[model samples]
Target: MQLTEAHAETGMTLLEGPVFDEDGKLLVVDVTAPEGEPKVMRVDVRRKTSQTVHTDGRGAYTSAQFSPYDGRLYLTDFAHGEIVSLPPDGGDLRTFFSGEVGGAPMNPDDLAFDEDGNLYVSDSRGLTEGEDIGRVVRIDRAGKEATVLADGLAATNGISFDADHRGLWISELTRNRISHLLLGAEGKTASRHTAVQVDGGLARTDSIAVDADGNLYQGLHGRPAMAVYDKYGERLATVEVPARQAEGLESATNVAITPGGTRAYMTVSGPAGGYVYTFDALAEGIRQSNGG
Candidate 1:
């Protein structure tokens, strides 16, 4: 298959945290660069109209999603290291989780919830001074203790569980690999394995989510695109930008596949590339062609 590029719908900035709502609308975190306020933007899947749901006094939103159970909109504040929760109908912003782990200075990059309503956060903490002991934290529904499921990771970024709730997948950014952990049957050890390694030299994967067929779609930073991989870590296919304007790399920082698996949306953060791109999934074609 040949590379194809679709221009962003226009007038978007520093887009990140792309997610799909149950109604099939596309929601993205819009963060203006270097000191811009953060806001949650919603795109009407039917009308294709984009509007802001909420704006932050702090810089752009890190990540966000519409809670299926409560219908509240939750977002991460990268600049302040706080989880901002807004009511379903939109109201005063409140801090959901501020330093859930002992007030450790860190930022919440991505998160996922399970069928049982357990929330998991992909925290990217200190990485420069070797303090990059990121974690997969599990927070109870009552907003109580945030238990560390696992630690000592390399920039833990995005997370999602399998459909059956027996497995979890995490994006280890610094290591440039996805780690799969089998959930314990009865508080047992979470068996872990390398799901897939980033090819083409550390694409610097940002956020990842699973498709209906159990395939994983990862954002390939520094190379404006999404890399598709099977459950067994086989490269299925790559969807990339059509035009490479300059030598400087374009980074696709976040990704979300719609519930139905027909559309895949990714966020780009390059100077000329901070808009979301949409793609139609061809799982059968990708798997059959093998990296086509």
Candidate 2:
């Protein structure tokens, strides 16, 4: 695959959480700024330019997702342990949910919504600080209440629903594998099993995205490649990212495919610097509106 520069290095301390807006513009979170602040940015692919859409002086922002039900952008503030929302038209931001839910601290890392507008959040529980208590919670469409779907996860990070909408996939960063949870009739996790494990060249797995054909794309932290697997968890292909493309391409933190599935955007963060890269996709990505 030919890797192209979507946006050049911007001196971001860490870049993660990439998703395409309705207009096909790419949105990403700058976890920490060079001056030690958190912000969200929007990138125009055709123009090869980016603009800061939102900034939070409180804490680091890790992820952003456009909610199909409310027509707003939801974000996870990892440092403050809260979930906030930004207006679609680039208006003021507001707090959506915060504080402890289910008697556990809510340190949301990544979020995914189901077809019915219910939000699934991965509460990392400050894993970066050597905490192992992680939980996956489900927030209703109204954002009034949250229910814990799964708890005691090593490090709940990337999350996505399958193309078929029959299962939910979550990356266990500390375990170095992906877990597939079968959805029950009531839309809860009925059972879960290991879907993919990093055994050979790869180390920890971060964020994940699914294509229309149920293929999974995973970002490998220790390797300069995105691990691809079929629906059955069988290894399919590995897309090697060129290290020369950026200073720290080896640490692929997140992956986001365009609505057309023709292109993919990724976030790389390491000691060298942080960057966002784009490349041609082998398959069509599942649209976020379809609960991807």
Candidate 3:
């Protein structure tokens, strides 16, 4: 899918979030949509058509996911330093999660939810305060408790859980490495370690998704590709952008596979405009892929 002339804008246009709602609607966020443009778009997977479903006049929507419990769409606002929510119809937009955590800003880049309704946030600010200044936060099922699971990261971007849901795969974008945060029995405390280290060359690690078989899909930014790795950090395959559209669409930011299915989709944007490319999944997608 490629942006039509109707999407022409003056400044940069970035498409990030690529998740399906409860109704199976594919949604993506335009993080840099200029004034008077819709920041969110909905695509019909079969028809290959898209529509402007959300235009709030202002905001930098980095990523979006639907709450499994309530079915409300939640977005990570990098510009507002908070997370916001609304109905699928784009009504009643309201702040869902905000404020500081661990005395540092909540520069949320991407988010995912576990089956038990716990929300995980990739708190990233790109080393604003100091080197390796990212943090991972988890919000309890009740949405009241926001606990810091891990910190001291360099621009942590993507986040997802392993097949067992016993740990989270976090992407350190700056270092081009993925870390596995193995949760303790209580699910609060965790032990972390470097899991997959990639040599992306010009591409930076962005969002990630996990399959039912414990495979991790890591999105690349400077290049139109996704790297699939096993739970043990072994590279499996590289999902590429469509050949015809590979010329100028290098800003591949995220991927979302069909839950329990073999369909994989990636959201990419660049001078050519924002687009969604599809491929076959290496394994069946799981809750971590849908993020709902």
Error of 3 at 41 (Å): 1.3
- Quality of model 1 by C-alpha lDDT: 0.65
Clashing pairs in 3: none
lDDT of 2 by residue, 1-292 (tens): 1112223333335677888877888777777653323377777877878777776457567778888788788888877778888885565788888888988678788888887778888887747766667888888878898888887787888788888888888887777788888888766889988888865355677777888888888777676567888878888887766747645555777788777666787777665556666777667767531222
lDDT of 2: 0.74
Candidate 2 off by > 4 Å: 1-12, 34-38, 126-132, 200-202, 288-292
CA RMSD per model (angstroms): 5.8, 3.7, 2.0
Give the candidate order by descending lDDT: 3, 2, 1
Cα-based TM-score, every candidate:
0.83, 0.88, 0.93
Give the Cα lDDT of each candidate.
0.65, 0.74, 0.81
Model 2, position 177: C-alpha lDDT score: 82
Question: Local error of candidate 1 at 235, Å?
Answer: 0.6
Model 3: runs farther than 4 Å from truth? 4-10, 128-130, 242-244
Worst 10 residues of 2 by lDDT: 1-10
